[model samples]
Target: MSTANRSVILAETPTAGAAVWTALAGLAVAMGIGRFAFTPLLPLMQHDAGLSLVQGGWLATANYLGYLAGAVICIAWPPAPARAIRWGLVSIALFTIGMGLTQQLWPWLALRFVAGAASAFVLIGVSAWVMPVLARLHQSARSGEVFAGVGVGICLAGLTALVAGMTAAGSQATWLGLGVIAASFALALWRPFSSDGVQATSMAGGARAPLTGQAWIAALCYGAFGYGYIIPATFLPALAHEAIRSPAVFGWVWPVFGAAAALSTVLAMRVLPALSSRRLWAYAQLVLGLGVVAPVFAINLTVLLFAALCVGGTFMVITMAGIQEAQRLGGAQPARAMALNTTAFALGQIAGPLTVSLFNGGLKLPSVLAALVLAASSLTLGLTARASARSAESRQQTEIHVIRDAGDARTNPRFEMS
Candidate 1:
């Protein structure tokens, strides 16, 4: 369809609601099935495909590297948000199906790498396209509903894996199943993400601003968040399996993790309406740190579940807050800022699994290190917020003084008539 026709259709329909739901479904496929379905399927692959922990870590690293590449590409030469999202979702389905068809590690690595890149594109595209529309419609709060899709996607993927485990299905079948679901979602979303469905005013037609010092700091802290949550996010199911030998029982870990993640975004919106995004992000990071270290004290079902709740609960909250903060600071170039943060985040993710592989899959030291990074980064973000507040206050006070001086001169008639 032509851009004019697409605009007319969007105007005739419930544009805001449709955009939000489309973004939600798109994210579910992108993050849930494309990026994280592998996480839940890892143990199954280990069992049926003889995939060792080291191999799994390598697979994860390859995906993260692909994510980094995608983010960098966005920064260098971004495609239109709608176009990127459409193609990204389609690519995810194709690559994911390819995963099911292959048994070789090299092919798996290649497929996963491409899938990872596609996931990044969808994530950035959704954020770029949907957020501006919501803001324009005076429904910025609805963004929570949109981001909640990530958790929903994760939850669905986990449940599918759980079912597969309970029924003694092979990893290949589960992969194919998720791929089909992703394809279905992509098909449904294809039209809604038309190039002219909703214009990204925030992202389009702006002289891009360079990243500031504080922006760089935020990006680095976001990277810390990526490293902080990823180990548990990537290996929670496997960790639970070690604690509880039953697939039926251990499979609950990922679903619980996903559930907490999905719920937390909505709750954060209602519970902390007054909180600043930076503060919210800092607090979530602290909670995530605790979750990251939870399994280290004792590796059991309870501890693992607690860890899942903590990590899953806060990761999405942190993600939403961090990206919102970037948008606030990005100043006519929010997409670029978002991509920079995502690139940093992807680096952290790459480090996380590599850390596990380096330690030979040991959790204690890696968990402790990740926690420390989270703590330190949290402190930095908190401090940055304080500094920004002070800077604004000082500027306001100076402006007030100048206004007072001008008024006094006018009243005194010493400078007004001259």
Candidate 2:
């Protein structure tokens, strides 16, 4: 290649790689540590801190509520995307570290809530921050690389918990170590998220068209995605702990789950061209529902691992596809639509834990409920697709009628005389 061409390629390569990694770091902390660290840590807390399943449910509920609150705030009072993302990263690190400093249940609850909120901001912020750059670079395919950070973070969290479990490090020390890891990631990400992206004035622009009936269905499906995944995502390790009674064995559950999640996103990115986002999302939900129901019928190690893979594999794909569909339907201004879907998702998360709590650790009931919800949502998407097609056909017929009527009016003698 000529020098000019070689220089251009070199510059583009580094910028693209940097953007991808920055997004990965932000997601790892926001999603893996901020959102899901609770999963692996829950078993430890239950073992050492006298935390009950009901209490664990409550704690999960609190985090979901915080996530909901943060989504609401972002929708209502939009901020600069880059700035919001940086602040979210910092807050996640602090709150995660806070988890280690206190043993009081209430304090832990408060910290989890804040961390949850931070994670939501990070998610939204990362989307708003990274998407525009990718759009400009015409490198949108790399979006999957950025989202894979969630799985990476989850893997790390699981590893941290595993080592702690093996050494009998207890919940307190586990929390401290995870916090340190999160904080280090936060520092390393500080310059990238801070200095790399340009600030958008607001994620949500002025009023856009109202959401369509199909969009409403998509939002509901997004919520169902949250509900369907949370139970397995949160409690799998605990179940593994019960079945295996060895940290080494149970620890593998979460890491495997995370590995599946990370791998799934990359695969989806490649496979998505073959399928529409809506169809892919529906199929994923179907798979997820089956996964949720699997553990109910069987409790062996094999069944549990397969279930974890199901949940992990589809959760992120559903999320990415749901948001993409929102953008597709929302047209120029999708921020509001994305936020609405996210809020719906957070609400679903809140409900999942509460539902689990109500059943008093009744795994079958919650799992069955999740499967039904996923199935219903999948069916709803199918109906929405049909409705959209019918609406388009009706509009086409109406336009043809109007054009013929206008042509006749122009050719009429009465109109010609005038």
lDDT of each: 0.87, 0.82
Winning model by TM-score? 1
Cα RMSD of all models vs. native, in order, equals 6.2, 7.1
Model 1 weakest lDDT span, ten residues long: 200-209
Model 2 lDDT per residue over 41-109, tens place: 988998888899889988888899989988988888866666678889889888888888887889988
Which candidate has the top score in lDDT?
Answer: 1
33-66 per-residue lDDT for model 1 (tens digits): 8899999999999989999988999999999999
Q: Which stretches of candidate 2 lie over 4 Å from their true place?
A: 1-14, 195-202, 386-418
Give the Å shift of residue 97 in candidate 1: 0.6
